[model samples]
Target: MKKLILVRHAKTEQLYDYSKSDFDRKLLPRGHKDAATIANQLKNKEIIPDLFITSKAKRAKQTAEIYAETLGYNPSAIKKEQFIYDGYTTSEMIKYLSQFNSGSDTIIIFGHNPDIAGFTVNLISDDLWHFPTSCTTVINFNIDSWKDIEVRSGKVELYIYPKMFK
Candidate 1:
């Protein structure tokens, strides 16, 4: 079986600066708190990740770092995948997972919304319309290999977010 944890980056600053790219935007103070909140929840649940993958975007990386710190994971080990940049699609995410077939049984991926939410829906039909900031969803696939993961081939094992606690 393969377990995948998908996380949406925490709330980022909605900056109006035209000179800055969206990829460079940093997380807000609330984003840090919320990331820690959800990470702690996963820690309490004893969810240990075999690998940590994250988007190269600034906010996503920051959120992943916060979660790593809270969960006692090595922040330096978190992979900043460049292909998972801001405009990635659901199919791209599926293809990305296929590359990790042998090594990691359980993986945690941190990324942006619409993309991550769409990836979750394409995997399990979870009807996730609004994947809020700092949200984490666990999907369990019956298949032994990540390459065998087809559309709706997984089950939602857990769904959590910071607001769910508040």
Candidate 2:
């Protein structure tokens, strides 16, 4: 069995300039605090991932960095992908995930929504109400390899939110 953790980036600051979509906006102060809370929670839960993949966006990258630092994992292990930047569909994320080798038993992906939300609901059989900011869904799949992952074949082991810590 392999564990796949899907995390939505923390809350972002309001957009002041329209030069870029909300995707380019950085996390707010509350978002940083919440991300740290989530990171600590993950550490307490011993939910550490062998590999961390995050979007190139500032907020998502910062979120992943918090997790990596809190988990005592080298930040260098985190991979930032350009395809995850903006407007990526759930299928694209899944396809990118499929390319990961089978050597990694645990993987965490930090990206945006409704693709993340959609992926969680569609790929896993369990009920996921929604994936709000700084929310995480951990799914376990019974497969010999990453390539064998099939849609709706995963079971939700845990769902965590920053507010839950308080």
Candidate 1: how large is its RMSD? 1.3
lDDT of each: 0.88, 0.84
Residue-level lDDT of model 2, residues 1-166, one tens digit each, is 8889999999998787878776578888889888889888878889889999998888999899888998887888899887766657656666777787667888998888877788888888777776779998889999767877778999988899987877
Estimate the lDDT of model 1: 0.88
Q: TM-scores of all models?
A: 0.94, 0.91
Distance (Å) between predicted and true CA of 49, model 1? 1.0
Q: Candidate 1: misplaced stretches above 4 Å? A: none
* Residues 22-57 of candidate 1: C-alpha lDDT, one tens digit per residue: 989999999999999999988898887889999999
